[model samples]
Target: MTQTVMHLDDTDSLERFDAALDALEGHLKRVFADDSAEADRAVLAALQEQVRVLTEERDRLLTDLEAERARVQRLKEANEEVSGRLEGVMGALKDMAPALQD
Candidate 1:
């Protein structure tokens, strides 16, 4: 026996619910026959697996990029510190050289 919902509208909330139920029922029926069921299951499983892998890869890349940015910031700070020290040393050298000449 086929079960059907009447007045199916994709726009209305009730229609959406009915459509979803109908789709599930069809998927189940297709799943019953060996060839149809197996093919549908395989396609769905493959799609879900691919989505999972891509999600993980995206998350990993985001983490790596953030780490790289942080490292760059730290190096910048270190470079600034070195620059300040060099300027101070140059100033001292200038002062000592003038006194030695006098």
Candidate 2:
């Protein structure tokens, strides 16, 4: 079995490379010119908009959650204050009960 090896000169190699690059560029242009490419771009734009909207919504929700947490803390503190005052009033009422009974 004999195998023949073929090699191109520098000029021929360069021409082949240029031709390959031109063919690739033409193919890419044709692909991008198709309707599907436009549809792909539109889909990408819609997805980006959705992501932006979702991010804004997430940030708003986080802000609302923080406000709710702060409100809960305030309510808890107010509840503790009210409970303390109620306990003092109950103790005073208990101390007066014996006098009222007499």
Candidate 3:
């Protein structure tokens, strides 16, 4: 059976992940309920492999999320520094405004 791959890159990723897990669990239950022992064993092995792959994907996504969060923090700090310097420059310009007017 061909399985569909879902990318978990958005805000609803957790929900999608849960749904995928549930689907896998349902399939496992159906396999156990089946009377064909050999076929069920094969299906079970395949399902186990899919679970392993999904777990690895989840770990990779978590690592990516951490890196993205760090990047955002760095950007925020840089933006604040730039904003402060711009405010200081504007204040200096205001101080020179009266002299220029006179």
Candidate 4:
């Protein structure tokens, strides 16, 4: 049998994943409930392969997200440092203006 491909979003939740799996299982059960041996084998093989690919893709995205979160946290720290320097500069300017007016 030819492979069937699905385009699933990377951010799907565990509940959603479970539901999708359950749905496919129910569909297969209904479709193959009194079918010949050949059809039952085909359905089982297709489900196995599809589940493998989907789980792999989901794992990859979660790994990528963790890496991205770390990068964003570093950036946030850098921005805080810059903001502190700008505040200091503004304070210094404020002090200098009062002295100049004397």
- Clashing pairs in model 4, backbone N/Cα/C closer than 3 A: none
Q: Each candidate's TM vs. the true structure?
A: 0.57, 0.62, 0.68, 0.63
Flag clash pairs in model 3: none
| Cα lDDT listed for each candidate | 0.66, 0.68, 0.80, 0.75
Best by TM-score: 3
Two-way lDDT contest, 3 vs 4, winner: 3
* Candidate 4 residue runs with Cα over 4 Å from true position: 1-15, 18-39
Q: Where is the poorest 10-residue window by lDDT in model 2?
A: 5-14
Please state the error at residue 55 of candidate 1 in Å: 0.6
**What C-alpha lDDT, on a 0 to 100 scale, does residue 73 get in candidate 3?**
100
Ranking by TM-score: 3, 4, 2, 1
Question: Cα RMSD for candidate 4?
Answer: 8.3
Model 3 CA lDDT for position 26: 83
lDDT of 4 by residue, 1-102 (tens): 995444555356645876786687677666667565466587687886787787786677678767866876999999999999999999999989989999
